[model samples]
Every structure is written in C-alpha cells, then in structure tokens.
Target: MSDAILSPDQTARALPYSALAQEIATLLQDPTVAVPPRIVQALQGGGSLFVMPAADAQVAITKLISFIPGNAERGLPTIQGDIVVFDVQTGQRVALLDGPTVTARRTAAVSLLAAQQLAPRRDGPMLIVGAGVQGRSHLEAFHQGLGVQEVWVASRSRASADALVAHAHSMGLQARRVDEPNAALADCPLVVSTTPAQQVVLTARPRSDAFVAAVGAFTPRMVEWSAEVCQHLARTGTLVVDTRDADHEAGDLLQAGLDVSTLPSLADVVGQTVAWQNAHRPADGPVFFKSCGWGGWDLAAARCLERTRAQQG
Candidate 1:
C-alpha cells in the first residue's frame, strides 16, 4: 500500500461550508455510527500534538492538530494542522483538508445542530464571545445555519471585537461590537463562547430560556464560564455534552463543584430524554452545550467532503 495525499486547495474546491454543515448534521443523527478516538502526544515545548483517526461506512480520515500556547506572540496561529481522508477498505488516500478551516466549520456546525434541537425557533440577535478563528467561524455558521438578524461581537480586546464586527458587516451582517460581555448576553438569546480564558469571563448568566454553547475549554485548567453559570445550567436547563467521560474529566461542571454523575450526555438529548427531563423538572437556569471538539465529528465532516469531491469529479 502507498500513501495518498490531497492538498488544501483541492479540499476547498471539494467541500464548502454549506455542504459540510448539512452532512455533519445528518451524521450526528445516527447513534450507531462510530467516531475515531484521539491520541495525544506531548511535545518538548509545553505544547501538545493530537492525531485523530476516524471512519464510517464510506471513508476514513485522520487529522493532526497541534497546539502551542506561545505561538501568538510570534504572529502564528495557536492551533494549526491538516486533515487526510482515505478509502477505509483499501487504505488509499483520498484528500487532505485545511485543518483550521475544517475545525472552524465543524465546531460551529455542531453547536448549530445543538441549538436547533434545544433553542427556540426564532430569528434574533446572537452573541459571540471570542474574536479569533473560532469566533469568526461561529459568525459564519450562525449566518448559514440560523439566519440571525443581528450579531454582537465581544472580546477582551476592544479592537478585536470591533474588527470582527467590521468583518461581519462587510459580509452583509448587521453587527456591532460590545465592550461588556453582559451587554452582549442581554442583547442576544443565543451566545457562543470561543475564548481560551482560564477563568470565568461572562459577567452575567444568559437569559433563563437562552442557549449557550461553550467550546473554548478543552482542558481542566481552562474554563470560560463561571461556577455560578455551570450550576445554573446543571440545575435548570438541559446540559448536552459530546462525551460523558470526557466532560467529567474536563468541563466547567467539575470545576463548578457539580458531580459528573449529575450531567446528561448528548446521546441523551438525541434520544429525547433531555426534553422530558426538562419538562418534568424544575427551573434551574440557562441551557448549556459544552463541546471539547471530538475527532468523530472531524471524521464525519471529512468523509462528507470526500464524497462531495468524488461526486464532482
């Protein structure tokens, strides 16, 4: 067997964001499907490297994502890498995807799917709490998936927030920059947090019926929501997680003094227990979705991209 390779340019021509989001949503509906597990290797410079390999019936894909916290000062991206798709049965290489773009699209799509399931069906203002790649991607996803009327960008750096607002407006979105996170929360019922802060930052909890998606913290030491917020989510709304074990190991719930046993898995939500649990229960607070960015989602998205390429060819 030989190694097969497809470059970033080829991936762009093959898989666009619109198609990727639809395929990802379809893949998430099936619980019988399998997702690849992630393997982490520690680097010498206090950074970590990840190799995620996954496949379904049609094709398999492997992604390599590297994280170096100190790269920002050097004008480099903190998260960088590439994705390779392959023929699952023959082990032939199919395509190579831009990791950052793929990650951004898939992450936002996952959140959008969760929102569709949990949030009320209405078009209104939305808030994004980070101004980096993930933050920008969330804006695109919300536009594509939810058709939001207005967008509010909020970041620690005022300039960054203003820049994102400018970008959004250029894309024909009604957007503005907000200096305070609470202001953003107050204005929008839907909020997405994409920061890498070590402690809670959002000043106030989201509205009682609001939906908040937190995808920034992948480690135990990093958290974007406060303990009070997590407690509110656990008590009132449906908290959906990608993996129960993973969330138990590294989520705001654990840090907020809540037992892992108390939370529900995304599987539960897909199975329709979340709604029942919510209806039969008391008012706890806001609904929350915490995603650590699963490799299975990458595999699913990569597989969809591969299929699109094949059909186009």
Candidate 2:
C-alpha cells in the first residue's frame, strides 16, 4: 500500500470537533490504548524538541514537534512537526499527518470533554483567550460540541483578536474582540485560554458556575491565570487535569499549590470509574481544567484521520 501524506487542511477537514471529541472519549476508555511518556530533548543552540508515541491494538503513532520561540518573530508558527501513523500488525507506515493540526484539534476536544463532564450546561458567551492556532481550534470546539453561538476573543494584539473574530463569523458564530479581558472573563460561562505567556493573562474574577479550560502554559514555569482563579478552584470546584503527570508539568496547578493526588483525572471520568455524569458541582463555583498535552490523544487523532482519509478515498 502506498503511504499517504495529509496536509494541514486535510488534517483539519478529517476531524470535526464533535466527532473527534467523541472518539477521544472512547479512546481514553479503551483498555488497549497505551501512551508512553513524551520525550523532550534540548536543541544545541536554543529551542527544544518533543517526541510523543502511543499505540493501540491496530495502529501506532508518533508525533515529533520542534519548539522555536524565535519563530514568531520570523512570522512562522512556533510549533513545527508531523505525526506518523503505522499499522501495528504490518509494522509499515500508513500515513503522515500534520502535527500541529492534530495537537490543536485533540487538545480542544479534550478540553471540551473536561468542560462537559465538570460543568453544568448553560447558554452564555464563550471566551477564548489567545488568538493562536489552539485558540482558533477551541473556538470551533465549543461552538461545535456545545452549540456555543456567542464567543468573545481576547488577545494582547488587537489585530490578532479581530482576525479570530472574523474567522468565527465565517463559521456563523457571533464573535467579538474583547478589549477588556476582565469583562470577558466575568461574562462568559465557558472560558478557554490558549496563550503561552509566562505571566498571568487573566486577572478578572470569573463568574460562579463558569467552566475554565487552560490549554497553554504547559511547563511548570509558565502560568496563565492569576492566584484568584486558583483560590476559587480551591474553595469551590473540582480541579480536573488530563493526566497525573500534569502535576509535574502544569504550572497552573503547580503554582496554585493544589494537591496533585487529590484532584480527579479526566481519564476517570471518560472511563466511567467516577460518577461524572451525575456528579453535582457547586452551583456558584467554577470548574477548572488544565491540560498538559497527552501523547495518547495524538495517536488516537492520527488513527481517526487515517480512517477518515481511507473513507474519502
């Protein structure tokens, strides 16, 4: 069989947010799914490289990503990489997928899953912080997965924020640029932050019963939320994390000084080990989710994309 190469556009087309989120939920529960710890290697000069590998019964996937902070100044995406999918039984490469696209879609799906499980369903404005790739994907996720019609985008760059709003409008979503970050947080019931800023970008007090998904700031040294958000989680709602390893890499959780073991993992909810569906949360509190990027999601999304391409062919 000939190996297929999937471009970023193809990759994005293959996985609709709602379907992708459903597949991810099933993958998380499948006992056959296996993910090894991601390997991070420092480059000789400046940036870093990450290799994530995962496998199930039928296929395996490996995603290689290079992080170059200086790429932004060069007008290039900071993340550059690809995902390779292999047929486990034949040990042959079956397809190649765009890495950053997989990352953005899967990450947003995971965040949507967490939000659905932890927070109550309501109709209100959804807030997206950061106008990067992840931010754009998450806007689609909330809109597709939860039927969020109203959206607010917050970014340090006015142009970037406006661009995101335009994209949202193209998708038939009611989106607007939020100049006041604080006001956006307070008004939106669903908030997702995809910025990579080291300092706190959101200082506003979120409304009680809001759902907050922090997608960026994966490293222990980087943070996105102020201490106020942390304190709110500690006092009122449950803090859900993608994996326990996030305790080491998620600065949002680490800096908040929360007990890692005490927090519930998203896997438990997906696996139905916890009574997540019927679980009652505080009526006037916030449910927070912090993702540290999982390798298993990469493999599952790659497999899904391959299936999609095959059907299209």
Candidate 3:
C-alpha cells in the first residue's frame, strides 16, 4: 500500500479536536504507550532540531521539527516538519502528517481534556494570549469541545490579534481583538497563553474558578507568566501539568519555585477514584494546567488518524 501523505488540513480533519482529546484521554490511562524524552540538537543562531518519538501497541511515530527562532523574520514558521507513523507489527510506514498542525491541535486537545475535567465553567468567555497558530487551534478546540461562545485574542502585533479574532468570527464565535489580555482576566473563565515565552505576557491573577492553560513555553529558559502570578496561582489554586516531563520543561512552574513533583499530571486524572480526586484536588481554586509538549500526544494523534481511516474504509 502507498503511504498516505496528509496535508495540514487533511491531517487536521482526521484528528478533530474532540476525537483527538478523547484519544489522548485513553492513552493517558493506558500504560502501554511509551513516550521517551525528546532529543534536541543545537543549531547555529539559536535554532534547534527536535526529534520526538513514541509508540503504543499498534503504531509508532516520530516527529521531526526544526525550531528556527529566526524564521519569524523570514516569513516562515519557526516549526516545520512532519510526523511519520508506521505499523508496529508490520514495520511499514502508514502515514506522514503535517507537524505544526499536529502539534497545535494535539496541544490544544490536551488543554481541552484538562478543561473538561477541571474547569468549573466551560461555556463562558475565554481569553487567548498570543494569537498565532496555537491560539487559532485552541479557539476551535474549546469552542467545539466545551462550547465556548465568547473569545478575546491578544498579541504583541495588533494585526496578528485581529487575524485570530477574525478567524474566530469566521467560526461563528463572538470574538474581539484586545490590547490588554490581563484586563479581561476577571471576566474570562478560560485563559490560554501561547506566546513564544520570551517574556511574561500576562500578569494579572485569574479568578478562582477559571481554567488557565499556559502553553508554548517548553524549555527552562522560556517563561510566559510572571513568577509572582504563577506563585499566586500555586498557592491559591490547583496546579496540574500535561505530563511528567513538565517537571523539567515547565518553565512557568519551575521559575515560580513550585515543586512540580507535587503537582497532578494529566496522566493521573483519567483512572483515579473519586476519593483520590477529592483528596488531591482543591475544592475552590482555579485550575492552572501547564502544558509542555509531549510525544505521547503525537502518538494519540496518529492513533486517531488510523481510526479515522479504518472508519472510512
């Protein structure tokens, strides 16, 4: 059989946010999925080559992406590559999927799953800090998965913010571009930060019932929220990480001096007893889910694509 090379749009359609989130939730509870630590090769001028690999019972996938920070000025995406998935039993290549789309959608799906399990309010106003690919995908995820109706987009470039707002409007959501994301924090129950994490983008404290996801800053050197704000949330709310790897890569939590070992990871939530959840989770505080990238999510996306193909055939 010829290997399928899926365009970004095709890849995205196969792994819808709702279906992708459900796949991730299952993999989180399934112990057989093996996601090893990703390897990073340093490049000249602050670029990086990332090789992320993962496998489960049926499939194995490796994602190759080049992170060229200078690409922004060159009018190119900083991350570019594709995920190559193969059948584990036959050792044959099955599909090649766009990496950026997989990354954006799966990351948003991680946040979507966390929001479903933790957020006190799902269908309320949401604030997206950094209106880029991530912001756009997340707007679709929350809107489709959790029924978010209103959205506010913020970015350093007014044009970028407006683009995301317009994209949201195109999706039939009530959307607006905002100058200050923090100013709207009090009114939004959902907040997601997807900036480059060069500096802090949001400083204000979120409401007690809010569900805020801090994504896009994966390395120790990158940070999105002020240390004070992170610490405030840590002290006053529940902190859950997307995976165990966040203990090392979650700069937002690490820079705030919070011990990541004590936090509940997404993997811990799916199969736990109600008593375990009640004992570990806070009764009345915000939920701060720090999402660093994970290869396991990519594996889940591959599984979703495989299932989509099977259903179609």
Candidate 4:
C-alpha cells in the first residue's frame, strides 16, 4: 500500500509556520512516538548531506538537506533540499515539502518550543547571531512564538546584519543591528546563534537568567558558541540541548572539555525529568538550547500541514 504525494507548492499552501509550531508542540508532549533517525554524509569541501526520515502515529516523512559551505561565495544558498511525506500504514507517498523553507521554519519552531518549555518568561528581548536564512527564521519564530518585545540582529558582516534588521522592521518588528557581539548578548534575555562560523562568535557571557539557543554548526568541525560559553553553562547549570547527538556535532561543547554524558537531552526535558524541571528556569545563568537539526521535527511539521490542507478540501 502507498500513500499520496504532495509537492512543495502543496506544502506551502497546506502548512504554514503558525500551524506548524502548534503541531510540533503537541508532538513533543507525547514520548511514545518514534521519530526517524538521520543519516549524514560529509563531503570534502566542508559540506554535508543529510537524510532524515520520520513517522508519526499515522504518517511518515523524510527530508533531504545538503549544506555546501562554498555556495555562499557563489551567492547561492548554503542549505538546499526537499522533503517527502508518506503514509505509515499504507506505505504510500503523501507530499513533497519545500526543503529550504520547511527546514528554516521547522528548525526555528523547534528552538522556540524548547524556549517555551525551558525559558521562564516570553516577554523580553532576543539576540540573534548570524544573518543567514536560519537567523531570519529565528527572528520570525521568536516573534510569533514568544511575542518578543525587542530583537537584536548581529553578524560578522555589518551589511548582512543591517539588511536583516531592515527586513525585521519591515515585518513590523522592533529590531536593531549591532556591531558588537557581546552588546547584543547583553541586551537580550534570550540569545539564538544561527551563524555557521568556525569559531565562537559571542564574546561576552550571558546573564544568569538568560536563555541561549545555538542552532548553527551541525558538523563536528564547525562551532558557533565558545568553550567559555559551555564552561559558563556548566558552572551555572543551565545548559539544555535538543538532543544528546547535538553535542557530538557542536564544537563548543566538544572543545570545552566537558563530558558529553553530563549534557541533558531535550527529550528528558519534554518527558519531565526532575533535573530538567529544577534547572530549566530563566533564573539560571544561561540555558543553552543546542539543535543539530532533527528530521522528526520536519516530519511533524509536514504532517500538520498535510492535515490542515486536507481539512480545507
């Protein structure tokens, strides 16, 4: 038995960010479901190929994303790909989602979900590092999910940062560009790093009651946050990750000399562990949400979109 197939255009018409966020939240609460695992292929030119397959209680989805670092020089997208959804019971093809847009939205939504579960309050300024697609997506997600009051956008390229701020302002957001990385970190209670830099970009440490979401640098060799940030997180006891697997990909933690076994997983937090509950507050020094990009999340988003589209018909 096979399922129906949906093209990227169909997914766009079906699944939007608002609905996707809600569905992701619902799926996180239920632990009985199994999300498909991801297979990564590393290339010689600092690029990676990722294949993620996931099945919900009813349907299944797979997303294939390729990140080629060199694409930026060519004025092309670094991350490009597509997603395929299927019916689990029938083994039928269901839909195809726009990989770039879906990836950007789903990744940010997942981070926002973590913040909702782990962060203390929603009304505050957010600092976003990196001015790429993920950075823009994070801004939109935080605005929609958290109803943030103010947002600070920063990147190594001043022009890129300025452009991001302009885009945010056009969207009716209170946004500003900052040349100083630490200044941006200091201004916001929540900080999201979306850059693909090889080293840590944030210079200053976060406040005790701050939340940090590091969504960049999926490869073991790449790093966005610093060792000091990880060390500070350890000292403050406010570090949380989307998955244990992320630590293996995050250079900051691996280079920080901290035991990977000590990091808490997002699943444990969603499952309501005592350690997570006790230490997962904004009052803590800095709560770090590190994401390695999960395919299950993409499937969840795709499934929600599919249901909505079906209902409309």
lDDT of 2 by residue, 1-313 (tens): 3587989998889888877788788888788988988898878765779999999998899999997766766899989999999989899998898988888899999998887776665466888899888889898888888888988998988988999999999999888998887777778888889886568988776777688888878878779988767877768876777887787888877887866666667887777666454444556678788898889888779767766777778
Which lDDT values do the candidates have, in the order given?
A: 0.74, 0.82, 0.89, 0.76
TM-score of 2: 0.93
lDDT of 4: 0.76
Query: TM-score order of candidates, best first?
Result: 3, 2, 4, 1
**Which parts of model 4 have CA positions greater than 4 angstroms off?**
1-13, 274-283
lDDT of 4 by residue, 1-313 (tens): 2244555556555656667767876776665557655788988987889988777677777788898988977899998888887777777776667798788888888888888877765666888889988998888888877887688888888888998899889889888887787866666788888887677777578866777888886667778777886787777756776766675766667777776656677777777876566653444456777787777678778667766867877
Residue 177 CA displacement from its true place in model 3, Å: 1.1
Candidate 3 error regions (>4 Å) = 273-280
The candidate 3 region of ten consecutive residues with least summed lDDT is: 273-282
- Tell me how candidate 3 scores on lDDT: 0.89
User: What's the TM-score of each model vs. the native?
Assistant: 0.88, 0.93, 0.96, 0.90
- Checking candidate 1 for backbone clashes, the offending pairs are 235-284, 236-284, 236-285
Superior candidate under TM-score, 1 versus 3: 3
What's the C-alpha lDDT at position 23 in model 4? 81
Top candidate, metric lDDT: 3
Report the lDDT tens digits of candidate 1 across residue range 203-272. Answer: 5778876878888887667778888878876676667676654554555767888765555655566566
Q: Identify the runs in model 2 with alpha carbons over 4 angstroms from their true place.
A: 44-46, 274-283, 310-313
